[model samples]
Target: MGKPLSGKVTVVTGGSRGLGREMVLAFAEAGADVVIASRKLDACVALAEEVTKKTGQRALPVACNVGEWEQCENLAEAAYEEFGVVDVLVNNAGMSLLYPSLEQVSEAMFDKVMATNLKGPFRLSALIGTRMAAAGGGSIVNISSIEAAHPEPLAVPYAAAKAGLEALSVGLAHTYGPGVRVNTIRCGPFDTDIAKAWPPELRAELARHTALKRIGGPADIVGAALFFASDASAYCTGATLALDGGFR
Candidate 1:
């Protein structure tokens, strides 16, 4: 059979690093042109060059802070302008800050978390998913966290935002259904750049809690991502798939 994503265009926020980077590379390898977006323009540009060199697929690097409403709108416009159509969008940008205590969590911290994790996705989906519905069909994959379902003290704000993101996915699916698909990937801890700062004991504890006995790796996200982004998931919408290695 032909490549599942051949002739397709995909936009992935946070596409310059970590799990987002993995998905970007995999999509290009699967024969899709890509828009690589992140806060750092240089990183996005570097990865875009690498993508073209390695996969020979077109790559557009866009600098964006998904936390800002105007930036999200600009990103959507840039992607459509360059690619003409976007067949898939992956809302993968997220942030969680370290604060001493819940009482110490300033309004700024909470707002930033909500903006990046929940608000950005909602706006992007509304903008692009509307166009997707009008143009025929598309897929939107939201990257969420296990914390959404199982919140902990250190990440209450982030957890709340992710929970909202999951809810938004369901609503978007209904609002744009028949021509668009929206789904959530509720992820467990992965050994991404952020995990490098985790204490050894904490890492061990996380692994011990998972049925897989280990945290996920960057590449582990590819299978689920491809399935959802391609025609393989044609009938699936308003679904939440746990990609958390059986995190409890």
Candidate 2:
């Protein structure tokens, strides 16, 4: 019942849709000025307005492709310029490439998945974590996937990339400690429109196997995210809070 994160400034990548959008809104509701970023300017701007209106919190909208290092740099700079400092970062920009097999996968397709799903978060966390260290301390939450653990064959690139992200989270914590916390949230099939290529039957199957017996909405992730960004999880670092509802 404590408003533990009052006045904190947090940044969320991919804030235009899905879990990212929900987190940005949740952070605002919890009394944090949020910086929302996405590849689309209109989307980020729109979410910024919505967060401002809904939660009465300061929201800064930024356009950036997290896959590119330079764009990630600009995002951090823009957020800092808008809010003076950032206390939390959510590296949530990601996508998956579903192919039948490794033979069917194009190098370009594999690279795209790896770059966006893994390197993007790595780069963004690096830049933001640096800023956080300079400022004394901060929290970084990277959105990973249960696929990293379960390893879906059709999504080889995705699973591998997310696995790398989880690895980075653990490795990063050792380097960024005393003042910074780095963690990953291994998420399952969310109800966001993000799974455009996933067959409906497969989605249903995924839902059926989970202990919760349902696909989670964006809201299902808000509580864990808030804990990561707030003082509630001050002792947590180098951890992956599996948001998969205990799927097999």
Give one digit per residue, the lDDT tens place, for model 1 in 1-248: 67899999999999999999999999999999999999999999999999999999999999999999999999999999998999999999999999999999999999999999999999999999999999999999999999999999999999999999999999999999999999999999999999999999999999998999999999999999999999999999999999998999
What stretches of model 1 exceed 4 Å from their correct place? none
Error of 2 at 77 (Å): 0.8
How many Å off is the CA of 95 in candidate 2? 0.5
Candidate 1 structure, TM-score to reference: 0.99
* lDDT digits (tens) for residues 107-144 of candidate 2: 99988998898888888888889889889999999999
What's the TM-score of each model vs. the native? 0.99, 0.96
Candidate 2, TM-score vs. the true structure? 0.96
lDDT of each: 0.96, 0.89
Q: Total clashes, candidate 2?
A: 0
Give the number of colliding residue pairs in candidate 1. 0
